[model samples]
Target: MKKYISLFLLSSILVITSCDERFEELNTDPNRPGGSVFDPNLLLPTATFQHGDLITGYSGPILFQSMWIQALASTSTGGANYYSNADKYVASPSTPNYIEGNWNVGFSLSSRLNQMQILAQQRGLNNLNAVGQIMKVSALSVVADTYGDIPYSEALQAQQGISQPKYDSQADVYNKMLSDLEAALNSLSASGDQLRNDVMYRGDITKWRKFGYSLMLKLGLRLTKVNASGAQSWVQKAVAGGVFTSADDDALVPSDEANGYSNSSANALNVPDDIYEVRWSKLMIDYLKNTNDPRLRIVAEVPPAGLAANRNGLVVGNNDPAVQIGLPNGFDLRGGSFDISNHPNFPGATGSGGDVAIIGAYSRPTAIYRRRNAPVFLLTYAEVQLLLADAAVRGFVPGSAADFYRQGVLGAFTSMAKFGGETVSASAATAYINANPLNVSSANASLKMINEQIWATTSLFANFLEAWNNWKRTGFPELTPVNFPGNFSSGQIPRRQPYPAGESSTNGESLRAAVTRMGGDNWITRTWWDGGN
Candidate 1:
């Protein structure tokens, strides 16, 4: 729960900053290492060097999670964690609000990645290189996915002659990512350095390689729609070349919590939308309760002071004057939304609430955040296993579906153990297998079991990105879309994040080009990878 909340907060800060003038002020970095933004001398780069405007003795979880408000409910979180002043999920044409602001965060990180890539090559720091490139590609991939056909040709060239880059097609961006990943993996392998200062791996080269391969597979799998063959080819290549074998080797960035968690905003705001009532998306909560999954205690926390808990499972999105409960996504209670007058169930005392986590917050000794040294994982072997299980059923790849399924649960349990929590008893895993074993043919039955487990286990492992991805891909467990009486369109799960409002003013031509490429940027228009009816 800590890491999940931390990620949300991290993203909120990044997005809210969104290249604003005050952004530099937030970063009070004390270190001053010179020459080019991406100097090769600094092999193990810190946030201060890359971002310059940061504080020292303060760890940088800011670069940890890339925030993308993919849905309308996005504002609830932004309002709480980012702006710290917003009372409702309201945005006007003038400010464009937090959801739109996140687009800038993703791009800013990508720009840093580009800068790093150029400098590494120029200085022959090939040994210390690929990691930067890998991160850049990963960040840029999200940007392209969120806002199709972004300013690819001209982006990240402040040092170069171009400040405004032309938008590149999503297709081209994918092509570049694939090419860059391939090159990065090979480069890291060929150039051998001690790699002594890795926060993610504790200087483990093998783990980094696995991380790259896993990311490679994730990127490939996203194209499973129109490019099934291509997706398959990449998946196969990644598997054959080797990917993560266990969750411990997962890729993550550690938060610098030396200051009793005061230095990082993301670590501080770990609750749902920062307002607390994470109203168990009927889809999310029901699945665990139904399966008797024990991972539930780790995510939910009571609100700080006011709002009561929606205990009776007050069906979310239910906003009828006649109906008892449930409000639409982005429905402001201050407004006349009848369904959202106040939380009725488990609301916590003042400031006691928390957000959902990417991985388990209830690990053995203490939660990951309490460890004071836990890292933010980018990907893990457990996710790969779940994917493999999915593929096993689909016959897209060769493996025992049941075996892969079982391993995923066990591997996930093992990974969760490292986060200062109780080890998942083997009996529990066995019992789950007996009760909800993989049902090879009945896709929904097998998938529901797999995905629910994945969600439970990967709670602290992946952040909002994982949740959004699953919701977008399978629509399993079926989260109820927030029902707003005043919604601009039919109440449906939000599909893609809106382009940042700044794009309209700063990079209008490229932004419009992206919208044109992606069905005019409507909320309903699907991403290239999403293809469920």
Candidate 2:
């Protein structure tokens, strides 16, 4: 009886101890995963997709940069007057919200990447950590470029009690980004732990390295105007470290429409105003037409004759190069003197009566761009080659400028197929390159040609923000600014977008200090790298 009681007491003590030890764990929800068990790889795709989507979405790039650069022109007729913020440099009701778009999106992406990197570090995942670093640079670079100074060195440190982080000057931002990018690129290794759920490269370390270097080269080029020596150093390092050599190396994130991760630019363009009122700018089309560029047919389409047909996204338009006409920028549909119909050499309306389409004859972006699942291009071999061409022309490197130019032009043509569009034939691309050779006469002439091609290629790729940035740097393709009434930039092309309105209340001191250094907070004030100082 004594032995039996002892055995029962010991068993009861064990049961109570076990229950006490696992009390919290047993009550915890299995569906809610803790950070310890979560995979960092999942953050890569989300950051990558959001980066592309936010930049290309309706708010900033679509409503502002795209038209500001005259790549796409809109009439802003009827209820689509928000487009005037882009088309005429006139503030719209949504301008306040739109100006903050990139700032907000960039920081959001940075925060996710920061968490991913911290987690990666804790696990000793070098490749994941390096990738996170590279992506962070890419995201924050856009922010610094858009706004003169932004939260950089101290950004995304909320857990460490850094809610109102100081804004780093654009120059400091660029310097740090270049250094960090270089370090991250060197850290990536093939023998490292296997990376999973990679949406861009499928864990290919080589391609990621190339992407990093390519991005570095772009950043280097951006500093050419303000810091030429620094630009040369970074460009040299990028080339030596190995940049993208082919379209296969392009960093394109795939969109899954069925899974609700559709392309945002395409979605924005499908809106009634965007589909009907928006058309390819005359400057863009005329350049292609005059050069007999093969992309004219692949990118621009004239809608079928009628208003209904033009508005119908399903109706395929005439893609014949000869018939495509581009709409002149800074024009409107309102019947006052500024009406597009009143412009010289206006293509006549396509239909009569209720079916009449005033802008039907003008070219719209082709169906390929409107596809919801089209891949978003982050960086491409074509852009890298074009930048190399410029570098070579400026004696920043030893390579032949002409050869790089040829590669760039051909790569640009070949890259079009990635849009899910009609592929430009290799023979045709070769023919175009052969016929139009790079003019290696004077350094200035070569520089102009190279940067102009950059503008054209970037514009076609729907990277209008980059296109604008390059234009600001090189002053190439010499665009004429619209002097519409109540313009924001005093009849000049805007150099930088104003900061988000919330910055005043949240980080007012930092914001005011940065603004003081920048001269003003409005659009015309240049960034540090843009010759502000």
| Candidate number with greatest lDDT | 2
lDDT of 1 by residue, 1-533 (tens): 33323333343333433343332333343342222342442333332122211211111111111111221121232222332112122222323443453455566656555544555666666755787777667777766665566766567765465655778877778877888888888888644664534445655667777878888887887776658788888888788768888777766555554423322333333333322322223233444556665444443232222233222122122221121111123423343433233334412122234632211111111133334344444567778888778666656689887888888776776666555545668787677667866776687778776766655554444344554565566655455444444332245544555676667787787777777777766545776667435
Candidate 1 wrongly placed segments (more than 4 Å): 1-95, 259-275, 301-337, 340-374, 418-422, 455-462, 531-533
Alpha-carbon error at 328 in model 1, in Å? 10
With a 3 Å backbone cut-off (N, CA, C), the pairs that clash in candidate 2 are none
Q: Whole-model lDDT, candidate 1? A: 0.51
lDDT of 2: 0.83
Regions of model 2 farther than 4 Å from truth: 1-32, 77-80
Measured against the true structure, the TM-scores of the candidates, in listed sequence, are 0.73, 0.93
> Per-residue lDDT tens digits of candidate 2, residues 276-375?
8778999999988887899999999999899998888888999999988888888887788878889887888898998998864999998887888887
Worst 10 residues of 2 by lDDT: 1-10
Tell me the whole-model lDDT of each prediction, alpha carbons only: 0.51, 0.83
